[model samples]
Structures are given as C-alpha cells and as structure tokens.
Target: MANALSFTFIHVLCLLLHCSASSAQNVVFQPSFLTIHGPSMTALLYGFSSKITLNLQAIPSSNVTGSFVPPSCVPGVTQWILTSELIAKTAVQVKLRLNRSLRLCGNNETDTDCCVKPLCVLETLQLTACEGNTSQASLIIQVKIYALLGSGNMVFDNSTIIQNQVYRPLGDCPCDLTFNTCDLWCCCDKDCSTADFKLFRYRCLTGPFGGQFPDPEYQCSVQSTQNSPDWFPFLCVTSPPENNPYLGLFYQGNTMAPKPGISFGGSVSLAPALSNAYTEGSPILTIKDQYFTIPQTLNGHCVTNAPVAFLKNLDVRCVTSVQACPTEFPLQTIPEDLRAVVKNGIAVFVGNVVVDVTDQLATELNEFVTSSDIFGSSGLVCENVTLALDYNFHWKENGITGITLTRTVGSVTLKGNVSLTTRYSAMFLSGDIMSEPNSGNPGYQVGRPVIGGILNTSIGNDTVLIARSPMHLWKPVNSGICSSADVRPLLFGENSTSGCLIPVSRQNLTECSLLRNSVHSLQGALIEATLVARNGHPDALTLADWLNITYVTLNSSGVEDSNSSCADIPSHLHIYLWTLVSGFVDGIPQKDIKAVQISYSLSSWRLKCGGGDSAVCMDPAETQLLPITSSVTFIDIPLNTGPPKTRYQINFTEYDCNRNDVCWPELAFPITRFYTGESYSQALAKGLILVFFFIVASVLGNPWRQIRQIWNTI
Candidate 1:
C-alpha cells in the first residue's frame, strides 16, 4: 500500500513541473501592447465651430527586448523608433521632425536632450482612423474619434504635476538614474516645529537644482555645524502603492455629495403691453410652450413681477408726458365704468426691440404660456418670467368715473415654489464614474447648466474653467408646475369694489358709487346688484355658496314674518327664493325655496379622458364649496374677493339658472267651474217647465202634460 501511494505522488509532481516550465516560455511570445484600445480612445466636441488640435507623443519602448538591439538599427522584429506624424483629411499627411533624438538613458545629470527631444507640429485632424506603416513605427496604436459640434464628449487628465514643465524619460525612471529620481525622502531637524514643517518645499540652495522637494526628516542623527546650531536631518519615506512618485502627490478622488434636489431658478419678465392710442398693428413677442397663471387686476390683489428670465424683442413704452397718449392705468385703481386703452410703450432689459403680440398677449401673457421639452446634453433649465402690464382704463354705468392702468403688471415676489420639468435629456455630465455619468470636464460644452440651483451661462468671465463631481444618487424626479387652490367670481359689482348683502337699513344695491346718487327709480330702488355664481358648479342645480343659498343652517329663527300673506320660513331660505326670483319675470308665481340640494364635489380639476393636449381643462363640477350657514345679517349674495380673485360676467339669465337647477318646482294647471261643452244651462229652463206642467197635470188631471213630462224625462 505504501509503494502504491508513492507511485501516485511521483506522477503528480512531474505533471506540475511540466506545467510551470510551459508557462515561463509563454512570456517572450506575449508582448506588452502599450496601445490605445478602450478608454484611451476619447472624443471631443465644441458648441460652435472652431479650430482645435491634440498633442501627439511617443518614445522608444522600454521593454527588455528593446535594449537587445542597437539604437542605430531600424525597427525590424527587435529595434523600434517612436516616430510622430499628423494625418490631415487622410490625404494631406505630414511628418513631425525632432531637433534631436532623446536618449533612453542619459549619462550626465544635466543632459537636456535625453529628456526634452519630442517632435511637435499642429495640424487639422480628420474624424477617421489613421493609416500609417513606416519602417520605425513598430508600436502603432489604434484610436477612435467622434468630433461633433456640441456632442458632449470627455477627455481624461493624464499629465503628471512633477513633469508638467520638466522633461521626462521614455518610461518610469529607475532609482540608479539620477538624484532627481532617487532623492524622494523627507527629513527635518527636531528644532523645527511640527506645525511649521512643510511636507513639500521648493528651494534652490539645498537641493541640487532649482526645484521642489519633500519635507526633511529630523530623525537622521547627524549635524552640520558651520554657523547655525547642530541639527540632525533624519529620513521619512512614503509606503508602497501610495508612494508612487508620478501621481501619488496630487490626485483628487472623484467624489461629490448629492445635490439638494432639482430646483427652479426664479426669474420673471412682464411682456410689453403699452396700448390704447395707435390704431395700427405692430410687433409682439411670440410665446412657446411654458405654463403661465395670469391674474387680472380687480381692486389690487394679484399679478405682479416674480423673479425670472429675460424677454425677447421688447420696445419700451413711451412716457405719458413724452408722447401725450391715452394715459395708462395702473392696477387696483379701477375707473368708474372701467374703460381704457394702451398706446405705444417701451421697456429696456428685454433687448430693446418692439414685440407685436396682441393686447391679450401683453395682459394675459402669463396665462398664455406653459412648459416645453428639454434639449440634449445641455442642462437648459427653464426659468419663471413675469412681466409688468400697463394699459388705459375708463368706467361708466349710468354716470361716469375713470382711472388709468385698470389691469397693470409690476414687480412682485412670486408666490409659492416652482418645480422641475418632467423630462431630462442627455444634457450635461451625469457625473457617474465607470457608468452612464462619467466624472470629468466636458470637452467644449455650451448652453445653460443648473449649478447651485441657478442656470449659469458661464463659470466666470475670465476663468471659465469647468469641473465635474463624483456621482451619488438621491432620487430622479420629473415634476411639473402644480395647480394652485384659488377661485374667483369675476362678476361686475360683486368683485373687489362693491356688492349686495349689507344687513344695514340701507340696501347694498344703493351702495355702488355708480348708484349712490340715486337710491330709487320710478317704481322703487332697482335692486342694484350684479349676481354672481361660483366659477365652479355653474351647473346651477344645487349649491350652498358663501352667497348662493343651497344647503344652509339659519340663525335667529329660520323664518321672517315681514309679510303676513306667506308662512314664516328659514331666513336664508327666504333670501334664496328672493336671490333666485330676481332673475325671473315679475309674477311667475314661484313656489317657496327652503334649501338647495348638495351634489358633486370640487376639490381638484377633472382630467379629460379623451382629450389630447387639452387633457387638463376647467370642470365646473369640481368645486371647493363654502360651508352653508344662516347668520342672516342681510347676507350679501355677492361675495367680492376683489381684483384677480375671479373673472366677471353678466348677471344670471333666467333660462340658464333654471336649467342648472334640478329642483325647480313644476307649474300648476288651471281649473274651470262649468263644463261649456255640455249645453246644460239651455236645457235647465225647459226641464223646469216640463216639471211644472207635469205637476199641474198631476194636480188638474191633464194627461197631455203628463205625456210631455214623460217624453222630456225620456
């Protein structure tokens, strides 16, 4: 059994020895490529067309086999010469000549030719592969290129700090070469304070040449006593891996903290809206896709400047004193009958050009815009813009009152927060290393980039240097401008100025300045009011409004006994009846309305199922209703939030309101006392006479009368 085990072990050892010998022989055949294959083949792009060049480099290979052949020998299977050349458009090729050939290893320490001999020439580059096969070109490398305009490419940083200005050898310099390569140790005297000692310093006296060196080590117990105190200079050298002389000193790892999420840079510019004088067409700015929530001026509550971006092609409006045009009206100050116009106007900062948009364009430009698609690789973040609007105004109901700038725009801090767009294109470095977003300065980048939460056109005026950060992921977002929770009535008198519902002895109808002069018409005080319905639930069927009398709880006895003819009912109930009946003809004989039926809700907008770009539209059913109450202090049917709160329209029309109401009572049918179709009155007298004759005949024994009475009865 022992002999058998020994035989197996001997065979296994022989096999292992054979495998090792074969592996050693594979080295000479497997040559070090020293070629560009994957990552080295980088491309570059420029925003605008410009001339550019790349520095080409080469030196004799430092392989073991390279030294076996003589330097004078041409490159065959052994000796190789690193020759540089430029291929322009593949046809106009040119060779770069060196002043002197560099030595693979120089003999003297101060020999410059051995280190600085490099051939250099600038030439136009083609976006294609090179075709070269010269006698000395033994180590030809392959490179991939894609020079497109604004393509967002990348270039790696490979130049070493130590050799930035200094010349370099063919490869890594050996320790036996020169004092520059060997004297990398650090040492300092013990007298030097630890804080005062520098890790690296540049001095010409102590060092061999005029250059920098690592910190001196104090532990070396030796002294130089010429004039200064005896001091020892010990040694401290860096450990392996980290001690690499080429790149170990100045390398910053690619790492960056995640951003504070995508944010909107605040910017606003009002469109130029000076109008009301000239009767000819002019220039206006065209607005593309962008969301705008425009507020019209009522009393003084809405639509002003928010922080935003610059407008295009705007001509400043002429001053009233300068041009003598229709005086422009400022916002909040409504004229009596509210009538005005805008003439020629000019505004600077928006490129001083005349824009020819419509009157609606200037006033409603905010509402006229929405969001759009992002372009590629250039973080062209969209900014918010608000414009100051100024136009003319005049108002008249029966009398006349006026104020300019009825609905105007001015500078204002925007309300609420803005959000990021939903889609992101291939614009800007994703900052991911070894992945989709590689960290590095983009080669020849352009367009606005979102940095520190703002869109910047350039880094700085003089120093436009750009850098990228290491990638970290918090989350990806694609958001849009959200809707605000605001609704307004926009009804005429019911707006910011005045309305019905003053519980005082004087009716609200007589309160309007336009009507304050005359309280009564020939018949009575014409119930002066502009009835309004909630923008939502205009359907009319049933609603408990801050004004509309729907579902309500009345206080102070739910009834009013002003008229003895009708029964006492809920106070709001009676008002609801009156508020509604005012729109109807004088004597329609309407039934008593006590309460309104509550139906659909209005918390959010109703998205259209079949609509395309119009997916989001206003749906009257989705309303935010006011709670029903009956405090009954002469509740004004017109609740005015003022100016931008709502859009105004004519008072309620009977047909529309009645149609929207689902609970309106049916009319009664008339009843007649007599049946005209049957001639009963005509037959009544004949029947009476016949009855009398029959009675007489019965009394006087007349058979004829008795017969006639019988015939009549028949």
Candidate 2:
C-alpha cells in the first residue's frame, strides 16, 4: 500500500507541475535596489569568463498564497508553499567563483581579515513554485549567472601606465564631475549613444580616457535609457586608473624633536626650526641622550586628513651611562622631514605612512610577503601609489614614543592628481631602529632605501629600520583665475586702451588688495562672446583641453586661454562673471536655496526716449529686477558705467561709449514737481469770477435768507 501511494503521489505531482506554469514575468537575478552597494560587489574585468552559481531556497511563511504543496505520501514537500511572498519567503545565495573574491578591508592587515566578512551579499529572490520536481519535494532552483556589476561593459587598455592594481569597470563609482561632457549620466553628448550596440559594448562614462577637450562637450542625457540607469547627484571627482585602491605602510622615516632643540652630553638647548612647518610625534629610538616611557604611543594618518593608523609605540630605551633626559621635545611636520638623505653615519628620516592592507594581506599572506634579502620582509609593490597623510607622535623620554594618524576615514586608497610611486623602499631615519647598539654591525649605520612591509609574524626585539621613499604630491595649477560673482561689462573710456571693458592690470593684481578680492570672488564662470562683424579676425586656437593643448599663458593669474589677442589682459577677467546674490523673499520659510526666491538685479539699459509724465512710462526706479530660478548660479553684478550710449549735448551730441553709430533713445523720465508761475491772463480770469459772485450776492440782499425763503415758497 505504501509503494502504490508513493507512485500515485509522484504521478500526481508531475501532472500538477504541467498544469500550473509560472504566471509571473521572468525575474532578473539582480535588482535595481542594490546598485548603491552594487559597484563594489559587481566590479568586473573584461575578457575573463567569470561565472557565479546561484541557489534559491524557500522559507516557510503564513502570508504566502497559491500553494503547490504535494500530498502527505511524499517525504519532503514543504518548499512549494507560496507565490506572493517575493522577498520574505525566499532567499538567494551566490557562490563567488574563479578570480572573483570578496574583500573585508579595514584599518590594518590583522583587522581586515576579520572586520565584516559577510558570507554572501544578500539578493532579493522571487521563484516560480509550479515546477517542483516529483522526487525532490523540497524545491531547489539552481541557475548559472554571469559575474558583472551590471550589463554595462568595460574596456581595458593593457597599457602598463597604471600598475600593481586591478581595474574592475563599474558604471557607478562616485559622481564628482560637473561638466556636461564629463557627466556619465547624460546620454545626449556623453558619446555613449546606445544605438543598436551589442551586448558587450558600452559607451564611455567620460570622454577620451586621458582628457576631454577641443570639441563638443560630454553629451550627458537628461533621461536614462534601458541599460544606462541615470545615476546622478555625484561629484565630478577625477577618476583613478586602478580599482579597489589601497595604501600600505611605506616607511616610518624619523622622529623630530619636540621643539627645535636636541640633547648634547647631558644638557638640552634650542635649535633652528624649518619655517612654515608644524610638529608631529617621532618614533622610538635608542640614542645615547634619549630615554622613553615603557609603552610610548602615537596615532595619526599618512596624509594630513587621511585615515588614522594608531601605533602602539615601540619601547626604545638607553642602557648607556650618563644620559640625563628632558621631559618634553618639539616636533616637525611630514613634508619638512621626508626629503632628508643619509650619507656617512648620520640618520635621516622620511615621511610617515599608514595603510589598511589587512584583507589583501591576510588572504594571500605568503604571496603578499616575500623573504627580504635586506632588513624587512619584501614583495608588496608600490608601483602607482599616491598618498596624502598626516599623523601625530607621542613621546615620554627622548628615546621615542607612540603615533596617531588623521584623515578622511574610508580605505587607504592610492588615487588621483597627487600620487607617485617610487622604487626606493626607504632611507635611513635619524637614528637606527635597533633596540641595542651592535658595535660591529655596520649595517645598522647605513642601509639602502626601504619600503614599508608587513611581517607575517611579529618582529622580535630587533628593530627593522624601514626606509622612507620620496613622497611626491601635486596640486593643480590655476590656468585662469575667474571671479564670477563680480564679472561685469568692460568699462571702455578715456582711462582705457581697448574700447571694451578694461582688465585689471598685472601690477594692480600683484599689489592691490581690491583687485585680488574681486578676482577671487568670480571663481568658476564660463567665457562666451557676442556676435560682431570685425573684418580683422583674432587667432583660432582652441582651449577645450587646457592640459593637453599648447596654451599661451597670460601674464595674469591662472585663467589660461587660447585667444592670443586677449593675451595682454588678465585671462580671468576675460571670462564671464556669474553673480551670486543671496537673499530671501518675504513671508516664505527658507531652508535650502530652493525654498526661497532670491531677487537679483543685473546691469540693464533701455533707451530713455523723451516722453510725457505718464504712469505707463518704463522708468528705471519702478522697474522690478528678475527673480532667481532653475539655474544654480545666482549673481548680482553692479552697473557702474552710465549707459551703453549717453548724449553729451542736444542735437549736436557726442558719442562717448557708443558702438557702431547706434545712439540710445533719451528719456524725460524725471518728472518736474513744481508748476511755473501762472500766466497774467489766467490770474485776471479768476479775479473776474470772484467779482461776479460778489455782485450777485449784493443784488439778492442777505443771500442766505433770500435763498431759504425761495426754497420755502417753492
């Protein structure tokens, strides 16, 4: 009876499977909701056939409907419970394959391996329950999925310029670009037009990789397409060549004195300090004049505002006799001490750096560290490392102390306009890192440049003097200085050479504070030109990509331009000024700039034709200035010059600032307040009317009484 019932149940389940196919639409394995953290998960390298397997399992839920549960004869028929329960009832897990791996990155190597390692990035799953196999009563759906961040394709140029990193093409990184052409979201001009393109071909997120310039700007589509979801509200940050950027400890260079003084045989005195420099803490050392607290500690970052690398201070003390130590010492800044070189026996220090290579180091411990032929372990490469770091050092005695780091907290990433990796591991610091001096070991006195490294095991009592490389950081040069808020039409007059607006002179820019303030105010305005019919044309050089193109540097500040004709004046003044007027409308509660209407007046001119005193006249005083709207740029430019054209005299007029024989219409706008003395005839007429009224009153004899009697008789 049991065998027959089992066969009947199997047959019945098979029949039900055929009758009830899934009614829901084909579901995407990955959904739109996860793109926030999706970039990190989906970073895909092109040409690698990476695949991940997905397994779906159902959980029991009471709210689910549309059951496909089999009869009691089946052994395990619990999975086919519902259809409406999309997320609450079903769960999906992805198994990472081949080269694809998950990284739990953190502050140091030790923590990275243990920080937050999720078993799998959870995905919301929806499954069709109708097609449960007969024997496997508990439904288990397995599907083969491609390994990618999205359908968006990525291109890899095998040029070795960007080294020691992987490039996982992510469509959505961080939005740091403001230029339309550079805007990844814009579909119109981004040149990422998806017109009949195949499955593997994606458009450029930005213009040509190296730079963008000289032609039509990036065509950013206002609306997103089927594949390219409009990801916006991001900054236009410059893109780095490598992906999953991280920094490793390069070298702990040297410890600066607390102040500009050092210890001699037994006494401490003052010394010369570098100008425009500040002090951070120093590392522990075993110099004769120095002694340290049992556990000297300091914490700081590689770059000024970088992530902090808390250092449990190395304990360096002196057993040598006759060394009295001072309580406190001053410190020196990072860049100030990084360039010191070691020649004979004097110890010179380099800049300090702290990185969180925890996960990467932990995953490939042996692979990450190689046996060092020199002092410290080797193998980690610093091919294209870019860093900006700042840290603090704590000290007790002169020997050495603890360290603290500070910067924007995230991962220690190597990126952008200020990154340069050097082959030199490190240079010798001020004093040897050795715990005790070896009289015979010459290696302690002088050694080759040493890059920072992580030992798989802890360094014993011996101090490994890690060498510091020359850290190179770069700041973008100002091509042109533009003060947009104060931009106005050039005032061309007897004091000017060109009959247009006069640019602030180079001498005034250097000496005058007012000009500098004005220039600084108008920061990022675009320069445009009005149509003119000048037969003599200017130079035709383009300035779209100022970095790539040969630019004629103006004698003025940073605003570099292509126009050779306007070379004499400041390039910044040559650009347009966008005024920023910050105000509020009455009765409106203003929070953001959007919540209120800001009214701003620009320099305007209407030919004032001679007119009568009428309310309909277009008067300048009564005119209402325009209100701020959609444009983020808000400005209030001043109107200094009197008019576009002003008449010197009557019909015989002089054109002071008129262009192309065009004279503006004059206005009798100022209405005359007082009336001129009345004519003699008008005064006589008023006098006669007064006499006639008096004569009529005399004839009526008591006019008031006679008028009252006449009204009574009537």
Candidate 3:
C-alpha cells in the first residue's frame, strides 16, 4: 500500500511537469488534471500547465467532519506533506509523499469496513487545489471519491484565487466599479469622500442599499403607506433613516453576483427620428439615410459634414468638394409622414426672395440661368453646379411645418467633379414673414436669434414695424476693419467682444467731418433697433426695455475748425442684455429679455504735426493714414438660478409604539396582536391554552393508540 501511494504521487507530479514544459510560453493556467464537470460530484483530471506553482494541503478527516479520524496510524504520526522543486520558470516538480506507516484498506480490510473508517481509498484520486502564499496554508486539496468497487465515481470541483480577491458588499455595484475613484455619489463606493457625497443633489442612481434586496427605508416610506398610526394617528414618516415600518421576515444572502458579459458586445444605435422635435444633441435626419449637414470651418478648411442645429439660424460660405451639381445636393424636402405638428402655414416670403417648397423643384433660375433647359442638343451637358442653398424652415409653437430650399445653380463645367465656394443658410421663420423670426418657443434659448426692430416714431404705435431684424455683429475683414460682405447675427446667451481699426487718411479726417459721421452711420447699420423677445410676437415693451447706444459724442468740443485734426472718433460700444429665467422645459431654461443697456467710449489720436504730410494734413492730397479704432461688446446675463419650488412636504404627529400593538392603523405581523373587542390578556391566554392543548394531544395520542391495539389483541 505504501509503494502504491508513493507511485500515485510520482505520477501526478510527472504529468504536471510535462504540461508545464509544453505550455511555458503562455501564462494562462490550464491544468490537465482538473476538469470541473458540474455541480454533481464528478470531475476529470488533466495535466495542465501555467507559470505559477500549485501547493496541495491535506485536510484531515477530523478537521473536516469534526469527529472522524482513521485509527490506522498514531494521531500525530501519519502526515501527507506535498513537496516540490522549481526546475523551470513555468514548471514545478511536485512530490507528495505520505508517511510510511499509513495503511490501505484494500490490502487488509473489506470495502465496507474500509469506507466506514475511510481506510481503503482508490489508488488514484482527483484533487482540486488553490494557490496560496508561503506564510499561510495556501492550497487546500479536496479529494472526492465514490463507489469503492469502481462502478460510479464522485466529481471534484473548485476555483482558485491566486493572490487576492476583493469581496465587496453583497449586491451589485456596477457604477462603483472604479476602484479608487468616486463614482458620482454611488452609495456603495467607499472611496467617495464627504464632499463627493454632498454633490448628490438629485436622486441617487444606486439606492442606499446599493441594489440590495429588503431595503426598508425605500420600501416602507411615508409615500408608500396610506394609513396613520393608531392611538396617535397624525404621525407620518418624515426622514428616510427613521421611516422603518416593521416587516417580520428579513433574510438576505451575502454573496457577490457576477455580471453576465465580461466585455463590450456591439454597437449602440443613436439615430434620431423626424417625428420627434429636436432636443439637445439630436442629429438632423434627411432623405436617403443621410444627415442634413452644413459646412463648418475648422483649421482654415470647411468640414462639410457638420449638421445644422434645429431652430437656430446659420449662414456660412466655404470652399468644399461636391460630386456633380444640382442632382447631388440634398433637394428632397422632409417627408410629410415623419413631420411633427405644424401650428403655422408652410411658405415664408422674404422681400424679393420668396421662400416656398416649390422653389426647390424649379429646374431653371429666372435671371441667373435663363437660356438653359436640360440641353442635350449638341452633346453639350451643361452641369448646373450648386453654388448656394438656402433652407428656410417655417415653424410655429408646435413644430416645423415645411422647409423651403432655394439653390443657386451655376454652369461651372461640362461634367466632372469640381470644388466650389458653396454658401449654405438655415433659417426658422413663423408664417409668411421673414423679417419676423421666432426667437424661441415661449422663452428664449441659447444660440437662438435675438429679435430686434428699428424704432420709428413716425409710425406711432407701429414703431416696431419699420425694419425688424435679428441683431447683427460687424464681421471683421482684412486689417481689422468691418466689411459689407460678411454678416453675422447676435445669438442669445452668447457674450462676445470684437474690435476693428477703421484706417482713415489724415487729410480725409480733416476734410470730411463727414468721416466721423460715416463711422457713426456704420455703427448704426448693424445696430438697428430695440431688442425684443420675439419678432413675430410684438409686445408693448417699456422704455427701460429699449437699448440705448453710447460713445456717440466725440471729444472735439473746441476743435470744430476744418483745419483741426479729428478728435476722438467713436471708439467702443458695449451692449448689455439681461434675461430672466422663470422655469425649465425639458431641461431647457425658459427665459425672457428683461433689460437692455448700451454704452460707448470715445478717444483721440495725436500725430507728429512737424512731418511733411502732417503740415498739409487738411489738403486733399496729403494721404498719411490715421487709424480710428472702434470696438463692439455684447454681454448677456441671466438669473443665477431658476425659481424654487416645493419638493417634499411632511406632517408630523406624536405616535407611541408602546400604547398600540401596531403603530400604524394598517395591520402588520408581530406588532399586530389583538383584534377588535379582544383584550390583550384574554388574547394571550387563549393563544397559550391552544398551544398547550396541541402539545398534550400530540404526546398522549400515540401511546393510547398502542395500548388500545394491545388490549384488542388480548
């Protein structure tokens, strides 16, 4: 028996050494001797290899069963100690040698007698071991065997944690997966500091129990109950910690559950639908499964795939590449079925430019493309390249009603691909008026156009009707001067400051007092009217709501002579617009323009009067340049926070648990003892008497029946 046991130990070590030698390149452990079949007590062993050493520690039957121990050898004499030699970096030469005094039941004892003493075991047994450290009993080898005659066998199964294992609280902590980082007020995350917990202003994504079951705080709160406590009935659960309504049974397991998938699965879809109104970060959908995109300038080049935002006005020109011409452009309007509710009509008229849905269907331009009509007469295919496209969306309170697209087609080439300077603009208008644009729905939003009108006192009550336009900012051109070509409108909630140098010749500044007047007129060009909430909805705004300009008067009090150099041209204009937010709709702030304040600055530039050109500065030909710098700053301010509203209300009352069996009127177990008309003492007596009767009857009935059977036999 000793020889056979020694051979079995050598066989297991040889198999492990061979496996380790073959699998040295891979670090992943694959043991050939351990095949975990299932929960059933059967397993197959294979010689698998890994870089780590496996230690086997035997647990005595006395230690496991707490009573049984084989008497074959003395108490402390028989020992199963497994030793190993590290021959390779990835391999271990294991040699398990049991004491020589250890005896086998198969050689000298019957199978039943051996099993009763657990003496006669199989020559070879399957064992599962875990890797542990040197200072501790690292590995525990559990050997399972069945059917001593070899008819059926018990399976052995186990898992190993090499060095360490993290056992957090029982339930799932999905958001608390980051080890040392705070997971946004995750209740189960111990890494979160007090400051991190203070940031939990809203509802907790993971509850206080951290996804654990039998949470009394959340389940038995005041909102969950309908009845009040008895004796003192006005009491309501006020706080989450103190709101514990007693439930009799509370059993929970403390086992960590594993997530089903260990890795990311597939792509997530974030496609937007036309039937729904555009929200934050919503993508613009068009026909042919393409996004309706506009060119955005990035790093001195146009990215043509940038999508246009809904309800926001845009006009941009950039040199971009395009395939073909009019045919390739997104011409098809949004489908009618997918369209949201439209409160206003479809077409909008903008002075000479009539924006209608039918304009997109027009094949030839009236003045631009006159003498052409899809000509194929002389093998000449005049390619109508789309130079510009203007998309005007007519909308009301509901949603966008119709889209009007007017394309500027030019015959650039006969056929192939070409790059052209393409202009694209998207505007949202209400009904048929293009001058009157809807700033927002009910309240103003960031990036929406700011409505303003030129106040004309000549029209009396219709002063807002003279020339209504969205507020515009002077687009800077070469050398910091404003240009008539580029036009940029002011958007709500965007604060910006810009300046440009208007270079004027010294002679021109002296000759033309009209130069300062011209600068004044240029400032007034974009600064048209009083800022309004919305252009379409004309309100009777007070004088305080109207914007007032600053820095118009120059520092030329004593220098009114024609020979005097121009003193202090209007230099800077600061416009401040204040808005008030009352509430939020769909997480978007609802704001109204409250006040408008405008101020300006004036300064003078002194030149060397002794110079050749300075002597004849008043002369028409002396052309030494004098720069008149002017700046415009627009500041938008909103309230710090929206108006506060009540979140939760509580009604407190005195309720005593000692006076009443059930604190609340609702019946609960254990707490609820006596029913109606039943005294406490009477109920207790009746329960005790019933229990005594049952116990007595169970004890006496069995012997009486046996005695009656004996008497009948006699």
**Every model: Cα RMSD to truth:** 42.8, 37.0, 32.4
Candidate with better TM-score, 1 vs 3: 3
Error of 3 at 122 (Å): 82
Q: Which stretches of model 2 miss by more than 4 angstroms?
A: 1-52, 55-384, 387-572, 576-714
RMSD of 1: 42.8
- Badly placed stretches (over 4 Å) of model 3 are 1-290, 296-302, 308-311, 319-387, 394-404, 409-422, 429-431, 435-450, 455-467, 478-485, 491-495, 501-503, 531-564, 576-595, 605-714
Cα-based lDDT at residue 183, candidate 2: 44
Cα lDDT of model 3 by residue, 26-120, tens digit: 33222344321111121112222442344333324332223321111111222345444332223333434433222224555555433433232
Could you tally the backbone clashes for each prediction?
A: 81, 81, 13
Q: lDDT tens string, model 2, 21-86?
A: 211222222221121122112111111111212223432322233233331222232222222111
Distance from true position, residue 322, model 3, in Å? 13
- Candidate 2: global Cα-lDDT? 0.25
What TM-score does each of the candidates earn? 0.15, 0.15, 0.38
Which of 2 and 3 is the better model by TM-score?
A: 3
Model 3 superposed RMSD (Cα): 32.4
Per-residue lDDT value at 273 in model 1: 32
